[model samples]
Every structure is written in structure tokens, then in C-alpha cells.
Target: MLSCVVLWSGRRGSRELPRLRPRVAPTSLTRVDFTELVPEPIAFLGQAAYIQLEAFENLARAVATAPSLGAKEGLSAAAGVALRKHHDLIAELRRSGVEPVEVMAPFAPATDRFREASVGADWYELLLGIYVTTGMLDGFFARLSEGLPNELADRVRRILAEEGASQVLRHELERAIAEQPGLADRLALWGRSLVGDTLLVARSALRAAEPSGRIDEDVEPVFTELIADHTRRMDALGLTA
Candidate 1:
């Protein structure tokens, strides 16, 4: 269920239950039409790809305009790697028969809303936002890909496998935070805000994708694990969880 959200978002972009194992498509789920099920997840992946591309491009442009030659070089390297990953993911979606435009259309509003809500005031905040959002999406997708059909699952795995942009962002963030010692607490708060906005957008996305009321029990654990992973990521960044 949460994988659906993760996969769906992958086309775009957890908690834990105690004693809980991740859900496999129950035998009963085998009868449910995968074609019907797959569309939403694919849609998510498309939207996510678009958002990542847009954000990275924006970041690259910003860095290019800055006075720092070193920053520009870092941005160039990271953007090159990130773009390749996104292109590959998009190509895989096409091979899987996903209609990129139509699939991604519905998710635009939610993703856009998230972007709007998370507009950072400065470069550091903006960079951290990118890091938090991408990491969160990637973590969820990595866990959820297991339940997908092989072809689709393979694409998800590939997309999550890269540490390109986020790794670059983390290095930049560490440097920025080190330079301005007081920025850490403020950025930590900003990170929390990003998590909140992501959940809101995710919930909106789940509702749009699932059109059937609340998420079912099978997916509940996956959501738990996703949140837990998100917390760990925040901690890794020296943010308050």
C-alpha cells in the first residue's frame, strides 16, 4: 500500500509497525488488475522525475550565476549525474508503456503545492529542501519497489540506486553549516517543515491515486517505515528528529 504511494511518487517520488514485515501483494491482490494498479504509481514516478529535473536545473542555474567557481563546478558535476539518473528513469517508464504527460498531469498540482509551500529564503535552505525531499522520496521508493512487477520494480531500483544530487547537496550543506555555526538550528527547523509539507503532499497524492477512501491495512506498515527512514535521514543531517 505504502509502496503504491512510493511507486506512484516514483513516477513523480514510512513508519514501522512492531513485529511487522513488509507486505507482499497478498495472494488476493494477484487478482486485482495490475494494469489498473500500476498507472497511479507510474504517474507518481513521472511527476517526481519532472520535479527533480526542474529543481536540479534551477539549482544549476543558480550556481552558474554565482561568483564562486568551485560552487559552479560542484553544481555541474552533480547536475550531470542527477540528470542522467532522471533520464534513465524516464526512459524506463516509457519502455514500461507509461504515457508520461497524462500520467504526470494529475500529480502536478500536489507536487507544485509542495514546492510552493517549501520555498526557502536562501541558498542553504533551498539546497537543504532539495536534499530532504529527494532523500525522503528515494527512501520510500527503495522500500516499496519490492512489491512491484519485475519490469517496473527494476526501474524503481535503478532510480533509487544513485546518490548523485543528494550526496552533492549534503556536502554543500555540511560546508555551509560549518561556515555559519548558528545556521544549524534554523536549518533543522526548515528540515522539519519540509517533512511536514511532504506528508501533506503525499497524502494528497494518495487520495488522488487511490480515489477509494483511506489506505488499506496492508500498506499501513510501509508508511510507518517510510517515516522512520525519514527520521533517520534528518538525524544524519544533524537535524532534530
Candidate 2:
């Protein structure tokens, strides 16, 4: 089963972004045997495709609202890359003999909720949100791809490995923070706030045989790596994670 809850919290500059709490109940303190878990092929393809599509859509919107021509161009380029990834995933879905739309439909609501709740209140926040969230999720999906059938896994990894606008987004964020040093603190908090919601989305993508859809304890290390990567991304921007 899936459930979502949003909590509002005040931030620096009085801005607020709603946090999406995880659906799974809290992890038990006791240790348990590890069981490897991987989402089924269709679930993997559908979720991966939808995320790229959402990234493209969000970046396209960012392009429109960007404060300068340079930012607009950079974001437009990033959006194009995301769109291309989406198309590639859709093609893979077709090759597997499933309708793209139907395969992707089941994931739309949860992913959409994630996007909406995590959206930033301004250009800086929005850009940071895009940078932080997408980087984390891409790392996640790429890792999950390993558990897929060999050929499909290779294809998915290659597609995700294609360079996107991480540099552009990073440059833009660093510039913003440098210009207004105060933004570092706020953006750092914003980046920290995003982890729970982002991880929840990642957890939901796992294929669970249990009726409750709880994640296996074995997956904790994967999440640990994802969090570490997220911290590095934040550090690269000179922000605390």
C-alpha cells in the first residue's frame, strides 16, 4: 500500500516547502537477515521513464522563468537531455512489448506528488531542488538497474549515464550562492529537507512481495550510498547537506 503525507515547515527567508513523509512504517531497531530486492522489469522501466519525463517538464518550466538568457539556454539544454532519456526508456518499454503509457500510469500519482511537494518557492530554490533531487534519483535508478536482466540493465545504465546539465545547474547554483552568500545557508537547509521525500520515492520503486510494500533491510546500504552521494553534490556547491 502507498500513502503520502505533507508537513509544512518555515525556512530561511520565510520560505516553506512541504515535506513528503515516507510511506513505510519506521524501520525496526532490531537486526534481521538481509534479502536482496529488485523491482520487476516493467516496474523499473515505468518508474525510470516517468522520472525522466518529470525532470524534463520541470526543467522546461524553469527555462521559462529563468532570470537570464544564459540560464534559460542552459536549462533548455538540460531539459532536452532529460526528454531524450525519457524517449529512450519509452522505446525500451516498447521493445519489451508493453504499452508505454499503461506501464507508466501506475507510478504517475506517487511521482507527481513528490514533484509537487518538493518544488521550490523561487528560482534559486527551484534550481537547487532540480539539481539535488534529480542527481539523487538518477544515482538511485542507476544502482537499481544492476538488478535487471543483463541486456536490459546495460541499456538502462547507458541511457542514464548520458551527460545531463549537472554542470550547468551546478555552475548556476554556485554563482547564485556566491552572489548572495546568504543563500548558502538557506539552500543547504533546502537540500537537507529534500532527502526524506526523495528517499521515500526511491523506496517505493522497489518491488515488494509483501502486501504492505515495505522495503527489505538489505537495501539500507544502497540508501546509505545515495545519501553519501547527495552530500557530495551539496559539498561541491559549497553547501552543507
Candidate 3:
């Protein structure tokens, strides 16, 4: 969904940097200046990430239903990429400012849950939600894509129609859930972790920044309600424990 990469060099003195990239930050952290419009660069970049979630959730259903062993494993890998992309973006934002990442840390996924194999079900469920959230927000991209060369818009639309990434996530979810009976519990816990950590980091960002903290609509109540629904569904599925 991201059309191009903009690499940002962290803030220097009182001067703010500019948005430069769609990224995967280094495994070993790096620091840079804060760009003035770091989070909302090319409108679609932010928008696409938001709406990709719709496709993700739908695909998760496919994962739950897939019949092949190969197909199930595939969903896991695809979901992992989607999750990482999200992590990298937020990580990039935090790392760019003069502040240390630890001070404004993003999601810190539970090490233990990921370490155990039992968490596969939870992983698919959460992956689905993340996809749904991202996809729901993607609707705005049409406006963002407007005025671009016709070729780009056409290409993006084609990719969307195919639901490329979400398809991969679904394939894996089906396999994971079918094979990992306890996956539902594990995924529910993971979803809780994603929501909680996101809130913690969000509040921190809101507090640290000025009047209008986050401009993106996808980060607002609509997204929160969806997350709540996801949580409720998990509870209903008897994964509360």
C-alpha cells in the first residue's frame, strides 16, 4: 500500500526533520530527528496501513478453514510480515526523535506467548483483527490516490482487489488454528497484549506531543471500538482465562 519509501534523518537541535521513508528500522536501534509530518507522510501510506486490517480479518477466517498443512504454515509467515511492518513504522517514529525508544516504547509483545507453540490460535485471531483494522482504514486511500498518475492508482487497486497480504495471513491462520487447538486462548491473550501495549504507547505519545497529538483518523475511536469487539469476541469464545 505504501507507494514509496521516505527516509527521515532524526531531529537536529530545534529544527524538525522531514518525512522520508516507509521502513524497517535496524534491529539495533538508531536515532534520528523528528520530521514535521512524520506519521502522515503521503496520505495513503498511513491510510493503507490502517485499512489493511479488514482484509487481514477476513483472511484469518480462511486460515481457520484451510485444509492443507502447507496452507496453515503459510498464514503464519504472512501474518508475521504484516505485524512486523506495523512494528517497524511505529518503531521508526519513536526512534527518530531525540528521545530514547525506551522512554516512548511501542508494543512490547509478550516473549513467553510467542515462545510457546500454544499461542497459534490467538495469533490468527489477533492477526485477523489487525488486518481488519488496517483494511477498514484503507478506504481513504482512494482520495489519497487521486491526482496521482493513473498507472499507480490502477496498480494499487489491482493489488487491493487481490488482497495479497491478507490472503497470506488467512492461509496461515487456517493451518495454525486447525493444528493448534489451544491457539484461540493464546491468540486472545495476544490480542489483549496488543491492545494494552498500544494504549500504553498511545497515551505516552499523546502526552508527549502538542495539542493535536495524532492526526490520523484510523487511530481513533472507530479503531478502538473494533478492538473492543475483538476482545469481546475472544471472551465469548471462552478464551478469557
- The prediction achieving the highest lDDT against the true structure is 2
lDDT of 3: 0.38
Give per-residue CA lDDT, model 3, range 57-119, as digits (tens).
434554565566666566645555544444433343344453323422231232122222222
Runs off by more than 4 Å, candidate 1? 1-41, 65-67, 204-213, 216-218
TM-score for candidate 3, please give it. Answer: 0.34
lDDT of candidate 2 over 17-62, digit per residue (tens): 3233443432322332122345587878889999999888789888
Model 1: number of backbone collisions:
25
Cα lDDT tens digits for candidate 1, 1-241: 1122222232222431222233442322323222332335575577656666655665675476544787778877777766776677677668768776766677667677676566588878877777777677666545444445677777677776876666667777888788898898898888766765665554444443443534544344444445565666767777674
Better of 1 and 3 by TM-score: 1
Candidate 3 has its poorest 10 consecutive residues by lDDT at 1-10
Preferred candidate (lDDT higher): 2 or 3: 2
Candidates sorted by lDDT, best first: 2, 1, 3
Please give the distance, in angstroms, between residue 85's alpha carbon in candidate 3 and its true position after superposition: 11
